[model samples]
Target: MQVKLIFSALTMATLLGACQKAPEPVVTTDAWSPLAQRYVSLVLALGEHDKSYVDAYYGPAEWAEQAKTAGQSAADIATAGSALQAEIRALSATDTMLRLRQHYLITQLTALISHAQTLATGKRASFEQQAQQLYDTLPPQRELASFDTILAELEALVPGEGDLTERVVAYRAGFVIPQDKQQQVFERAIAECQARTLSRIDLPQQERFTLEFVEDKPWSGYNWYQGAAYSLIQINIERPIDISRAVDLGCHEGYPGHHTYNALLEQKLKNELQWVEFSVYPLFSPQSLIAEGTANYGISMAFPGEQKMQFERDVLYPLAGLDAALAAEYAQFLKLMAQLSYAGNEIARLYLNGEIDAATAQSLRQRYLLQSEAEAKQGIRFVDTYGAYVINYNWGKDLVKNYIEQGGSEDERWQRFISLLSTPKLPSSIAWE
Candidate 1:
């Protein structure tokens, strides 16, 4: 029997979990922002089984309340689920980057539906049996991989596995990246951040803020949150960035970037009803459009009215220890990897959606990502199950660039930029015409 194989290079990206919820406040805090409460509720429901992760991200009291509501009114579940979907759809539809995310949201919805449907039937064993059947049919490359394993890994990092209140306390305590190494990284990041700050909105250093990185933790590169805290940012030094990536990513991740923009908004926008939602970010909310877009455009926004080629040639390349030729080659390689990731994601999504054969999926991964035969085989299984999310990194970057360029620039435009981001529940399609 000629068995078909789906190459697995694309699948490797699928395993990289993304985003995280912010830690909730301890005191009442004015009933909390409705958007924040909404996300807190959803995380509590979807992540209830893993108290540690929920508590670590959402906090103790809020997680407890959310847990109570999870089994409450079906209307509440429907409301939460619909709101999430609506928010995501609005954000994604505004740009191609977000539009790609529509696919991801749908996949999550599908899984939630399957789970809910099983529960509605009131046949516990039957639900398990059906899930098992679904698992059984996954490609050999995907065999034996269970959600439990994924949850287990996540649980280890999050604190407070049981007791919502305890989980919340643990979440707050654990929300911070470690403290010992935080100052060192923060200092370096600050120095690095200043170089790019000229184009940023003017804010005092103290108000601008810095999050000290502490113990080694698994996180994406640093992220910024505008809240009661000023520019709440997290960084994992383990992910070393060469200079080119640093300049662009630094601008994107830090000053004149996400951190700068977020901090400015927190300070400038205090109209209780206006900027409150922006202060407390919701991952799938329209606020995400502002958060992700400027962060993505930080480099371009800072360097606008300047020569990008010059910066690449004079600043970034030399810092990375590469000559012109070598830099060009490395740049090309990175671009190719991004393209391959995009292509692999398309193939994976098609396969998972039942549009392609397993072998075809494998070929796509191998041909595009240049994966080892075995890895390629496994990747197919991964992508088939996960669908098109790998596009977010580069594709999102492109969309953000497009949106910013479309917006005309004025003097110290970064200030205006911060204002836009602070707008309450602004949709991704929000343009500055």
Candidate 2:
């Protein structure tokens, strides 16, 4: 009986040993870094197909040439991208940074491949669908009627108006920064923005950017990152410049915004850790969500509370040759209008999906979001050019704002903001708690 029991135990042990699984292969092998490099190079090559595909590339110039040569066609690039992603999926990495970076690469590659396919096929996706697949997030589903409540809230703020949008437009018309004053006003605003940002975060000694005003661009502003602690920022002068835009663009295009965010990544990842993948930025990828969201949120983060209004009241208003007494009213208008930012996505959906015409979309933006006719055109133009990217401004702003404001004190918020700017963060990284 003892021998039979022992034999049974041995048989059980044998079965248990056989059931144990072999270790799975991972993508983080020794060649993984090189694969990452090749991926960036291929993306740069793919960028040649679309003028807006590659937002910035400060990597090895040789790699750019290689991308153009090796992955010359969109189909070829897509095939290579898919194969690389498969290769990455077959491997594992124990390190957190490696895993996150790999995931970021794969996510961006997926967008690139999809874009390539769309370009080749000449078939466009719905705004929401494209946004989800490319930017890695969805714009909140909303209807035109959904904004009536929001417009009512704004109406309660500003009474005695033919139309709330018209009234808001007329009220803000006086605050436009004159053509002659645009440069000096923007320079001063950027200086203050830089000072405030530097007071909160640690950045490299040589970090800086050159500001230029340009016209006829699809977007209002752009930061052309040059890598190695420098950026070239362009502000659109296609329409009348509002006084409030000084602070908005200052924090957005300069300090603690795109310039600051890009510089930190370049310094920490590319320079320090020698991570070559950080050298390329694709405008259509998940990174833009973080970029635009943090930038919009940075304005509030840097200027917090009544300080923004006070700063404009004390400095920007006077600089723009506008009456200072009305700053308070303008400030209130801005506060009310900010609440309706999500409406842009719905309007874009309606317009892009053929539910509404261009004229209808423009009118909806003006009525619900409270913009001037010129501003309405600009808003619609932006939608026409960038589809669901409209969400990056408000939805992204809300997400970043919620994440940073989780802690109580102002310093804690700034710390969280700084951490987010420095790291390779994704949409899920900042999901509301």
Q: Which candidate should be chosen as best, given TM-score against the real structure?
A: 2
The lDDT leader among the candidates is 2
lDDT by residue (tens digit), candidate 1, 328-360: 444443343443444554555456556678887
lDDT of 2 by residue, 1-433 (tens): 0011001112344344433332221224476777778788777877888878898888777778877776478888888889988888777867766766677778888888888787777777788777877888886787668778877877787756677877777766678999888887888888899889989887776566667778877777788887766677888887778899988998998878999999888777776767777888888888888899999999988888899899999998888888989888889878777778778788888887888999998898888878888888988988776777888888888878888889789888887888778777778655422
TM-score of 1: 0.51
lDDT per model, in order?
A: 0.43, 0.79
lDDT measured at residue 259 in model 1 versus the true structure, 0 to 100: 65
Model 1 clashes, total count = 17
For candidate 1, the per-residue lDDT at 35 reads: 38
Candidate 1 C-alpha error for residue 384, in Å: 9.1
